[model samples]
Target chain A: MTKITFKDAAGAARTVEAQDGSTVMETAIRNAVPGIEAECGGACACATCHVYVDDAWTEIVGKPSQMEEDMLDFAFEVRPSSRLSCQIKVAPNLDGLVVTTPAKQG
Target chain B: MTESIETDVAIIGAGPAGLFAVFELGLLDIKCHLIDILGKPGGQCSELYPEKPIYDIPGFPEVSAQGLVENLIKQIQPFNPVFHMGEMVERVESLGDAEHPKFRVTTDAGTEVTARCVLIAAGGGSFMPKKPPIPGIDAYEGRSVFYAVRKVEQFRGRRVTIVGGGDSALDWVLNLHPVAERITLIHRRDAFRAAPHSVNAMRELVAAGAMDFILGQVSGLKGEGGQLSALTLRKESGESVDIACDDMLPFFGLTMKLGPIADWGLNLHENLIPADTEKFETSTPGIFAIGDIITYPGKLKLILSGFHEGALAAQKIHRYVYPDKRLVFQYTTSSTSLQKKLGVG
Candidate 1:
């Protein structure tokens, strides 16, 4: 199992153990983490699961795909670090991934 | 006033479950009129991700969302179900009593449908435009700010600012350019998700200095009493710029909301209608619900589960539509009457 941490806008962090092949959004939803709506259920269709990867973990998590970037246009307050958590896969390499959920998702 | 449509069953929503319900009700010789807020059929399947593939649909190993919707529409074509598209249901009045229940469903577009029974197959409710998180933006809504361009005359001789990089933004920018005194297109990044042709047209206009293209996000709105004066935009460099405009249109796509359905007086559990597993009927007699908008003991939000619920609900609805006629369970493969209804006999 890979360990991942999710932090809310207020800096409250919750770390959970995510199984390999699952996504960060799935882990967040499995753990009942607040602020991650995942309205499209990880199809990367809706941008409600928008998250800001920590600056240190940006290189490790990698950039979003072209399709995800198109969908990100629907999100609010997007930044260089903004990525839809549904597109980020959970792996042993990303065991210590840290991401912050935005205050409001469009 | 136009004449109201009379049918045996009035099914709300044109999604997968609702479309399948028409087939189920049609097999029982029940005519139906489908009402949906979207202009076309396939609610979320067509609206959200039409090109995306779905795996869980029965029989089909894998099918695109639009592909499944097309098959469902074709499967129910023999029923000749009438469609009232692009209208939101405003009110549902129970006209008849418990023994012989009837409902008069009204839409915002002034369309009325009276039926022996009403079925709610609305998956996750209606889709509405997603609003940005700008503080105090609600005050300017329907006044200085608009989600949809109802009238092109409203932007005449006005300074308009269109936000977002999608088709809605670019299309409106090019459309309203002739009427508006000035058009400003604002987006967070340089890349656009709109059609390449529209993007090129916008860039050509920008090159000609006909309009302004700014790279930023709307951070705040400056206005008073539902009138917009200017909007504050934050750039990627952490710089803020205030652009003076009388009207602002932000196209951030759509989100599902349980709109108007909550006020219908049905017993709701966490915004979902509570229905029985057997008939899938709501607390209000003759009014049934299925699909994601309903909750039962083992309710799964899958399309197959909705198909099952709809099939069972049709059994009960058949009794209400033809109270004098006796119902005989028959399979389409073995029953000539069922095959005749399918137009395959």
Candidate 2:
């Protein structure tokens, strides 16, 4: 199990233990973490699961793929660290991965 | 005013479930008219991911989303189902009492369908444009900000700013270039998600200095009383630039909403209609719900499950459309009448 923390826009953080194969978006949804609405159910078709990776974890989390970058065009208030949380897979290497959900998702 | 259509059944969506329901209802000699908000037949299949592969469909190892929709369309072709595309069902009025249940369905495009039974196969409600999260942006909607371009004349002599990197943004940038005094295309990154040809054309315009292509996102909107004046663009380097514009068009894609379905007076279980397992009928008699928009014990939101629910719903619908006739369940494999209805006898 990998520990993942999801921070809301208001700075409230909720950490949950996620399965190795599951995604960060799935973990946030399973825990009912506020501000993360995965409307497309992890298909990466919609950009409703936009999140900002914590600066310290950027290198470990890596950048989004080309397809995910294309879908990010639909998200609001995108930044350099923006990622569609569904595309980020959880693993042992990402034991302490932290991401912040956007104020509003497209 | 156009005359209202009279049919034995009115299917509310053109997705896989509603299309299959046409075939099932057709086997029982019921004519149907399908109403969909999208201009095309396939709902999310065509809209969201048409090229994506679906593996769970029986008899086929793998089929594309659009391919499944095409096959379903072909399967129901013999029924000659009339389609009212690019229209949303605005109201569903129950015309008859409990004994003889009937409904008069109306759409936003002024199309009316009066049928003996109404089938709600609307998977995930209706697809609506996703609004940008810019604060106070709603105040400028329909006045100085627009999601769709119904009229090209509206942008004439105006400074227009088109945001997004998708087809809608690039297409409109090219289309409105001639009409608008100046066109500014804004995107977060330099890379575009639109067709290569459209991207090249936009780049050519930028090279010629005919239009402005900025690499940034719209952070705020400056407007008053539904009139947009300028938009604040924030660059990746934390630089904010205010571009003066009279109109702004953001081409963010679509999202699903449970619009108008909540107003139909049906019992909703967390935005989904609660239906019985046997007939797939809703709390209201003669009104059936199926597909992802329905909720029941052990209900799965799979395409195959929807097909099964539609088949059972047709059996119950036969009773409503043909009240005096006895329904005899038959299979197309051996029943000559069923084969004849399929046009394969």
Candidate 3:
């Protein structure tokens, strides 16, 4: 299992344990994390699961794909560090992953 | 007070599969009541892509999604299926033991439906729009801010500000431009992901001074009691512009959720309900699943496939509804009794 931390819009940090290979969005929804709406259910079709990867873990999470970039344009407050949490798969190496949820979902 | 309804079968979802289930159950002298979260039938075919053409339907070479839904409604008309629209099935509990089980299905509307069997045809579950992130935007909802245009008349003579770059936003800008007293469209960039023709039309409108297109983002709202008087926009240059608009329509597109079905105790496989290939029954006895919600080894998510599953489910449902009677195959065209039920005899 991988441990992930989600900082919600209110700046409250909540840590959750998830199985390796599960997407961050899936873990958030399963644990009832407040910020990630995940309306598309990880289809990557909706950007409601938008999150900003913490700068410390930016290198670990990698970059968003071209399709994800296009979808992010529809997201609210698009930032250089923004990513759709659905595209970030949890892995053993990403055990200390920390991401902050956007104040508003686009 | 919660309303109580008793039926032979409670079909959850009014999509093609659920509507078709009514016909199949009706042929066997069984009555059915359907519940749907959407106000109307057809599921994604109607809700997502109603005008899109579907070439894979068995009969016609090509038919619009809405046309297929209309045809399904007409085909099932003889059965006179009862429908409870605009309600979400919240919880499904088995009332009896395994051998002679009954289901007590409840909707979010506080309505309880007790049935001998339950069939779930929820196509990809519920359709929920991706909400835009504007701080305190919820305060203006249902007053000056709207996600869906339930009726065009609501925007008459109102100053409307549309946000987004997708088809819904552009289409509404074009549609509401005529009747709306003033229109302002806000996007982070000038580029749009909609059709080229729509983009060109929007540009034409901007050129004609019929509508204002701004390259900015909605940063603030001035409103009270769910009513908006003005919208504050932030441009790329860090300048704030306040536009007077009483209405804000934001369409971020929709995503499907499994919704309340996930809470039910049925066995789930990868976010989908696991159903037996024989009768499409879920892990729980007397509860069946069909359409996009069900999963099997080689199951295909298609309208025709769901139709076939509904037919097989009806066959199994007969045994549950009438334990003493043996099911006999009868052709609808030849059997007077079946034809009479179809109102065709």
Best by TM-score: 1
Q: Recovered native contacts in candidate 2, as a fraction? A: 0.83
Instruction: State which candidate, 2 or 3, has the greater DockQ.
Output: 2
Q: Give the residue spans of candidate 2 off by over 4 A.
A: B1-3
TM-score for the A-chain in each candidate structure:
0.98, 0.97, 0.96
lDDT of 1 at B288: 95
lDDT by residue (A3-49, candidate 2, tens digit) is: 99999999999889999989999988999998888887788899988
Question: Order the candidates by DockQ, highest first — what do you get?
Answer: 1, 2, 3
Candidate 1 lDDT by residue in tens digits, B1-345? 455889999999999999999999999999999999998999889988899899999899999999999999999999999999988888999999988999999998899999999999999999888999999999999999999998999899999999999999999999999999999999988999999999999999999999999999999999889999999999888999899999999999999999999989999999999999999999999999999999988788999999999999999999899999999999999999989999999
TM-score for the first chain in candidate 2 comes to 0.97
**In candidate 2 chain B, where is summed lDDT lowest over 10 consecutive residues?**
B1-10
DockQ of each: 0.86, 0.79, 0.19
Question: Quick one: best DockQ, which candidate?
Answer: 1
Clash count, one per candidate: 0, 0, 0
lDDT, residue A102, candidate 3: 84
lDDT of each: 0.94, 0.93, 0.87
TM value for model 2: 0.95
